[model samples]
Target: MNAESIAIVGAGVAGAAAAVRLAERGVAVTLYEAVHEPKPIGAGLLLQPTGQRVLAAMGLLDEALALGIRVDRLFGDTPSGRTVLDMSYRRFHPEAYGLGLQRGALMGLLWRRVRALGVPWACGAAVESFQQDGDGVTLQLAGGRTARHAALILANGSFSRLREGMRVRQSARLFPWGAVWTVLPAPAGFPQIELRQRFRSASQMLGLMPVGKAHAEDVERGINVFWSLPVASLDGWQERIGLQPLKQRMTDLFPEVEPLLAGLTEPVQLREARYADVHMARWHDGRVLAMGDCAHGMSPQLGQGANMALIDAHELSAEVGTGGTGGKDDWPEVFARYTRRRRAHLRFYEQASRGLTPMFQSDAVVAPWLRDRFFGWGGRLPYIHQQSIATLAGYKTGWLWGRLKL
Candidate 1:
C-alpha cells in the first residue's frame, strides 16, 4: 500500500467520485468494494443542478446529459385531478433543468472515470472495522486481512456496519414507508421531459420519470415507475397482494399509467427500496472520516441522496487538495473543515425531507388533505415559489439563508 494514499471504503457514488477527484488532483486513492464486481444499485434518480456542477467539475456532465432525460418540471396531482405539488426548474433559472437518469448510467460514467484516473480498486475488500492509530487508520477487512492507510473514508451505503465502530454520536431510523420501483420502456404519449405523479391521499402514490437509455447506443428510452407502500407490506407483497391487484389499484388512481403497468407480469419486476434517516453529531472521528450515506442518509423525498454524496466527494477533495505537504498531521483539520462546510447544507435537506415525507408517504388522513388544499397555493406565492424551486434545484444551504451558486 502507498503510505500517502487514502483508503475509500465502498465504490458507490461517493467513494468512486472521491477517488476520481482525488486521483485527478494527483493524490493516490485505493477504492474498496464489498462486491467482487462493483455495479450500480437502484433504478433512476434526478440530477439536480448542484450535482450537475460537481459532474461538470469532473468533466462527466456532458456524457451524463446525453444518457439522461431533461426534466423541466415535476408535476403531481390527486386522483380527482387536483394538483398537490408542482415545481419547475425553470422557475429557478431559464436554462435550468433536472436530468432524470438510470442509476446504472451514472455509475458507468463514474467507473469509467475511475479507470481513466488510474485509481486502484480492491474488490471484495469490505472493511469490517477500523482503528485509528497515531497518524493513520488500520482497516480490518473481512477474512481477517488488514490494511493501513494514512486516512480512511467511509462511503458505504446507509446500512453499512462499518459505521457502527466509528464511535460518533449517530442515529439511524428506518422509515415506515418505501417504494417498489422498476424500469420499463417509455410508453407512447408519455411526456418525455416531465416527472409526472399521482396521489390518492397519503397511502397511495405513483410516479413515472423518463430516464433515457442506459447506454448511448441503446435504441429505446425507458421510464422509472415506482409505487409507494409500507415497508412491512413489502415482504409478502408478491404472494399476499399479487401483481394484478396492485396493477388494478395503480391504474385506478392514475389511468394514464395503465399502459406502462401493462408491461408488468410478475412481482419480481419491481425492486423494493426502503429509506433511512441517519444523523451524526459530527462526520469525522480522528483519522477516519465518513461521507455520503454513511455519514448522513435521509429520505428520498427530495431526490438528494446521490446528489449529496457527489457534493460530499467534491468538497472533500477540495479540502484535502492533492495530499501535498500537509501530510498525516493535517487530516484531522481536513476532516473537520469538510464537516463544517457540509453541515448546514446537509441539515437543511435532512430536515426538509423528514418534514415532507409523511405528507406524501404516510397513512395520515389529514396530512394529505392539508397538502392538497394548501400546497398548491403555497407553491404559487412569488417568494415561496422561488425558494421552493431553489430547494428542488439543490441550491438551498439553509432554510432562510445560504444558496450555492452553480
Candidate 2:
C-alpha cells in the first residue's frame, strides 16, 4: 500500500483520462480494470470543443483530428422533408466544429498516453467493494486481493455495483429506449461534414454521421449509422422481426441510407446500447468520489457523455494538484471543489437531455408531432438559435447562464 498513491477503478474513457491527467501532474496513479484485455466499447461519438481542449492539453488532439471528420452542422428532418432541427457550429464560432471519431481510435490514443506516462495499469483487477475511513480507503478486489490508497475514485460506469455501497443519495433508471448502432464504409456522395438524421415520428429514428476511419491503415472513410429501438424490443429482435423489416423501415424513411445498410447482414453487426438517467445528490462521500457516468449519466440526446467525462478528468486532476498536497488529509477539500466546479454544467445537461429525449425517442404519438411542428421555427429565433448552438458545443453551464470560453 502506497500512502501517497490514489486508486482509480475502471479503464474506460473517464478512468483512462483521469489516470493520464493525474500522472502528468506528478501524482502516483494506479488504474484497475475488470477485463483481462480491455478495448473500447460502442461505435462512434462526436467530440466537442470542450473535449478537444482536454485532448489538446494531453497532447493528443492532432492525432485525434487526423482520425476524425470535422462536422460543421447537425441536420435532422422528417420523412416528408420537413426540417425539425438544423443547428450549425458556425453559429457558435466561425472555426468551431465537432470531431466525429471511432470510439476505438479515441481509446487507443488515451491508452497510449497512459502507457507513455508510466502509469501502473492493473488489468483484470476488479475492485468489487471498498471501505473508507478518516485515514484512507481500502479496496477489495475480486480475488481476495486488497489494496490501500489515500483516496478512491469510482469511474466504473453508470451501472456500477460499487456505487450502490457509497452511502450517497442516487438513482439509476434505465430508459425505455435505446439504440443499435454500427460503423460502416461511407456511401459515395454522402455529405462528409454533416451529421444527418431522419425521424418517423417518435417511434423510428435513424442517424448517419461521418466518422473518418477506425484505423489509419484503412483506405476508405467510414460512417456511423444507428437506429432507435425500445429496450424491451432488443432481446430476440432478429428472431421475432428479423433485420429485413428493420432495414425496410429505415430505408422507407431515408432511402439514401440503403447503400450504407447493404452490408449489415447479421444482427451481430449492430451493437445494442441501453442508457440510464443517473442522479446523485453529490459526487463525493469522505474518501470516495464518483466521476464520469457513475456520477451523472443521462440520455445521449446532447451527445455530451464522453466530453463531460473528459472534462471531469481535467477538472479533478486540476483540483487535486492545486487544492492540497498528495495526502489523504486534503482529499475532502479537493473533492468538494471539484463537485462545485462541475455542478452547474452537469445539471444543465442532465435536465436538458431528460426533457428532450422523449421528443425524439418514445412511444408517445403527439410529442413527435409537436417537435416536428415547432422545433424548426424555434431554432430560427435569434436568442434560441445561439443558445442552441452553445448547448450543442458543450459550453452551456445552465439553462440561462454560464458559457465556456473556447
Candidate 3:
C-alpha cells in the first residue's frame, strides 16, 4: 500500500518481528499492545532452521544464537527404560542444531530491535475494535482514541478478539492435556546439548529443555521444565492429591530432574498452559491480515509454535511485497497471495503436531502403548528417522511431500 504507517496489533513474536522488518524497510509501523508493559510469557522453545532463517533475514540471528542454549539432539526415555526419540540435528546438516531458549529471551530480542528502529509501541492501549474501508484500516483503542493506517496486521494471539471480528472461519480444538512449566537453574551436571524428555506413558511426560540464560534480567541462567498434565486432573494436583505424589513421580520417572526440584519450592510456583489448534480456512480478510497463533496456533508437541510464528513474519513480508517502499493498496491480492504461499507449510505442522500430541499426552489407553512399542524402533530407520528430524527442524514441507501429488 502507498500509505505509510501500518498498525500491528499485538507486541508478540509475530507482531514484533514484522514491525522490526517493516520499520527497517522504511515503512512507518506502530505496534499496539494491550499490556502496560509487554513481556514474553511461557518457558523454553526450540528455534529450528525455519525460524533462524527469519532471524537471519532480519539480521538478528547471530544475536539470537548468543542468547540461547545450543541443542543438537533430541533424546527421550520411556517408562519401560526404552528410548523413544533419539534424533540428532547432524543428520540434517553437519552444523545444523536447534537453539533451546527462554521464550522471553527471543521475544525480548525482537522487541529490542523494534525499539531500536524507532517503531512506536502503543502499550497499555488495547485495540478494542477496528474499522476498514477501501483505503485504510482504523484502530479504535480502549479509550476511543483512534488511529488509521494503511493495513492491519493481527498477531494478537489464538484467543484474539480481533480474529473473531474479522469473521475468519476455523475449526479450533483444545488438547485434553497441557503442561505446567517452570524455570530452574540448569543443573551443573545436566547436559545442555540436547532437548530431553522422559515419559512413563502418554499421560506422563516431562520435557526438560536447557534454556541457557536471559541477558537482560538478573535471573539469567536456567533450564525449562514442562510436565504434561490433564486439565480435568489439575484440581487433584492442587487440592486432592497434592504435589508430594507428583514430586515422587518425578523422581521415579527421571531421577536426573531431582537436582532441579529444590529450586521449584512448591507446585504453585509453576504455571499451567493449554494448547489449541486453530485451523482457519484462511489468514486474512480485506485490509486485515492475521498471522501467528491467531491465524494457526498448533500444539508444541512438535516444538514449532514460535518457529512458525517467526516464519510467518518472514513470509508475510514477501506477500506484503512492500519492497522497502510502499506499493499498491490491493488488499485482496496481497491477502490471497499470502494465504496461498503459507497454506502448505501451515497444513503440515498443524497435521504433524495434532497427530503426535496424542503419542505424548492423552487419555488414549492404546496410544502410549503403541508409541513405546513401535515408535522407538520406527524412529531408528534411516529414512523414517531423517523425516522425523526434518519435521523437528521445521523443514517438513519440502522434505518429501512437495514433489508428490495426492
- Compared with the true structure, all predictions reach lDDT values of 0.88, 0.88, 0.81
Could you report the Cα RMSD, in angstroms, for every candidate shown? 1.5, 1.4, 3.0
Alpha-carbon runs more than 4 Å astray in model 1: 322-329
Off by over 4 Å in 3: 1-4, 216-220, 235-237, 322-326, 403-406
For candidate 2, give the lDDT: 0.88
Which residue pairs in candidate 3 have backbone atoms (N, alpha carbon, C) closer than 3 angstroms, thus clashing? none
Candidate 2 stretches with Cα past 4 Å from truth are 324-329
- Between 2 and 3, whose TM-score is larger? 2
| lDDT score, candidate 2, position 277 | 92
| Model 1 steric clash pairs | none
Model 2 — TM-score against the truth?
A: 0.97
Give per-residue CA lDDT, model 2, range 119-192, as digits (tens). Answer: 88899999999998898899999999999998899999889989987889999999999988998887688678
Give a tens-digit lDDT track for model 1, residues 1-406: 7756899998989999999988886778899999997766568999899999999999999999999999999999997888887898888899999999999999999999999888889998878888887778888899999888988999998887788888799999989999899988877786798998899999999988998989889888999998999998987899878899999988988888878877788888989998888999999988788898888888787889999999998888788753465453378778888888888888898899988999999999998999999988899887888998899888899899798643
- Better-scoring candidate (lDDT), 1 or 2: 2
Q: How far off is residue 303 in model 2, in Å? A: 0.5
User: Model 3, 159-182: lDDT tens per residue?
Assistant: 777787786777667767777888
